[model samples]
Target: MSDEHEHQHEMPATHEHQMGSSLSMAVAATLHCLTGCAIGEIAGLMIATAAGLGNGWSVVISIGLSFLFGYSLSTLPLVKVGVAPLAALSVVLAADTLSIAAMEVTDNLVMVLVPGAMNAGLVNVVFWVGMMISLTAAFLVAVPVNRWLLSRGKGHALTHEFHGMAAAESGWRRWLPSLPTGALVSVLIAFMLGGLVVSIADEAGWQHSSSAAATTRPAQDNPAALALR
Candidate 1:
């Protein structure tokens, strides 16, 4: 009778602990997705804006890059430990798609709703502020979604199982692998795009300012006019 009572008491504790662990795992997973989304979205936006692309094009590019980066980040860890390409892709798509979609929608909506955000220049304070606010809203919205999915053994729960199995098989070898090549490549590409955008914008801005100065200068101040005089 005492043993039965003890088992019953432990059952509730075990369930509670499992629930807590799942919640923590969900939060971590959501954050990982968010980080990738942020990197991709910001890079795309900067690139488009610097290149003088219209707002519609910028949004399209941003969303596309967000998905690419989010999926890449999600799958990289699985592939590093020798998960098959197709299986890793499937798991990442299943685990991160909804969360990434939710975040992208929330953040983009926020940006659209904020006055001047879409048209704001890369150097504008409004642009940075709007991005910060939108990303925060995205994070807030995604957390609940992730938690709900994880509790039901969906979303990141699927990835967690594979990760656990991999860990068991490889022990610490799982952790010893450097960052996945895909992730490193994605980041590098984003940086290159951002740098290209900055260079283009700087050149354009300088040309515009120089032309404006030339047009506004008094004829008396012009070298050609002075030489003629």
Candidate 2:
């Protein structure tokens, strides 16, 4: 009975280690989502600047593409590991898109509202710094919110189901998936896209335009003329 009690005691320590592993996997998954989102968003901004696109259009394109690419980053890995294409695609899209969209909206709002950051041309150090700072701050806020959602098993639940499936499938699987690697690759892709946009915008002579102010008509001092004349 004592030996059985010792064995039971050891089980919890083992479970604790497994729980730690799960936590790491969860974190890696979220970070991957963040990386892909950051890249896609920055690239969108750059493309808008280079193409002389307005803020509205740039933001829309960036959001759409960011979500698409972010989902793809996650889905590709799972699909490669023999997960069903339809299921993998479904989960990644659902899990990462909401989080990415939330981050994008908040972070971009900061960039647009910050003084000297708006349409402020593509090359200003101050503008870039402001955008980066805003994004970082947004990320800090976003992580906990996302983590809370994940704890409920709702945020990353989709992708979580795929972790063990990689080993469950048969030989000659065409894909290899890694949460950490997928995240890194996605970020790199976004950075490259961003750099390209900046270069093109620089070459094409895109510059910030101060919005024109609306003019108001002066109130009629002619009211006196109407009464008298």
Best lDDT among the predictions, by candidate number = 1
| 41: Cα error in model 1, Å | 0.7
Which pairs of residues collide in candidate 2? Answer: none
Candidate 2: residue 208 lDDT (0-100): 28
- For 1-229, candidate 2 gives per-residue lDDT tens digits of 9999999999999999866765665566556776766667767877888999988988787777777667877887777767787988877766776677667777778877788765766565555666667667666656665666676776677676677764535555453555576648566657555755675566455332221211212223446655765
**Residue 191 of model 2: what lDDT?**
58
Candidate 1 accuracy as TM-score: 0.69
How much lDDT does each candidate structure score?
0.81, 0.68
Please state the error at residue 73 of candidate 1 in Å.
Answer: 0.6
Q: What's the distance in Å from true for residue 31, model 1?
A: 0.5
